[model samples]
Target: MDLQRQIRNGWFFFLKHIFNPLTRRIARTSFGPFAIVRHVGRRSGKQYETPIIVSPAKDGFVIELTYGPDVDWHKNVLAANGCTVVWHGKEFAVDKPEPLDTETGRAAFPPPQQLVLNLLGRKHFEKLTCKKDE
Candidate 1:
């Protein structure tokens, strides 16, 4: 495998096996802007909910790709074409998972978040739009 792919996989392993468990526990509450994405496994047909930090955009929300686009949940969302997101004490049917360039993605959020994204090397993002009445 390529070196970049290997590094990404290693980071994913740590997040999946370590960070995710702790984040999952804290994501259930309204402590912050944390959201939960409910999606099904592409190959396994298993349901999974993942915690994510999101900021509202004009027509949807911008999901920070902290771990890049290789993560399982991001792939699952793409494969499924849609998913349910629990955010800000409500559930939203989010669709249209599109990866935006760094400039476009950073423009979706406010100044503080944009600065943080830049600092974190988060150039990948998913633009999800809510489906009405879902």
Candidate 2:
């Protein structure tokens, strides 16, 4: 396998087995860029909570698609048409998850984060709009 693909697979294994579990322990309460995304599996109907980095937007939030748009959590949110996000110790009902272009996605993050993401070759992002009170 190519170095990039190997690295990607290794990273995925690490994230799934190590990082995600550790992150979940503190993700919901930690006052950092991380947040917990609550979504239900489309096929199994099982509930899942994933740790993710989120940047606040005008009326919602921006999420970097580090593992690309095909990741289970992203696919679940898309299939369900919405998901709840636990950010800064508060639960937010967000919907309308739409893909964003690289430039537009990068613009949502701070310069430092944008630079890091660019360096990591992350180009996909999704914008989740906050559900409005009726």
* lDDT on C-alpha atoms for all candidate structures: 0.83, 0.89
**How many angstroms is residue 35 displaced in model 2 relative to the true structure, after the best TM-score fit?**
1.0
> How do the residues 1-134 of candidate 2 rate in per-residue lDDT, one tens digit apiece?
99999999999899899999877767677566788899999999999999987899999999987778888888899899999998888899999588899999998999889899899988998898999998
The TM-score of predicted model 2 comes to 0.87
lDDT of 1 by residue, 1-134 (tens): 99999999999899889888777767677765568899999999999989887878877888887778888888898899999988766788989588888798888878887888788878877799998773
| Candidate topping TM-score | 2
Clashing pairs in 1: none
> How many clashing pairs in candidate 2?
0
TM-score per model over all chains: 0.79, 0.87
Q: Give stretches of model 2 more than 4 Å off.
A: 1-11
Please report the candidate that would top lDDT against the real structure: 2
Model 1 weakest lDDT span, ten residues long: 25-34
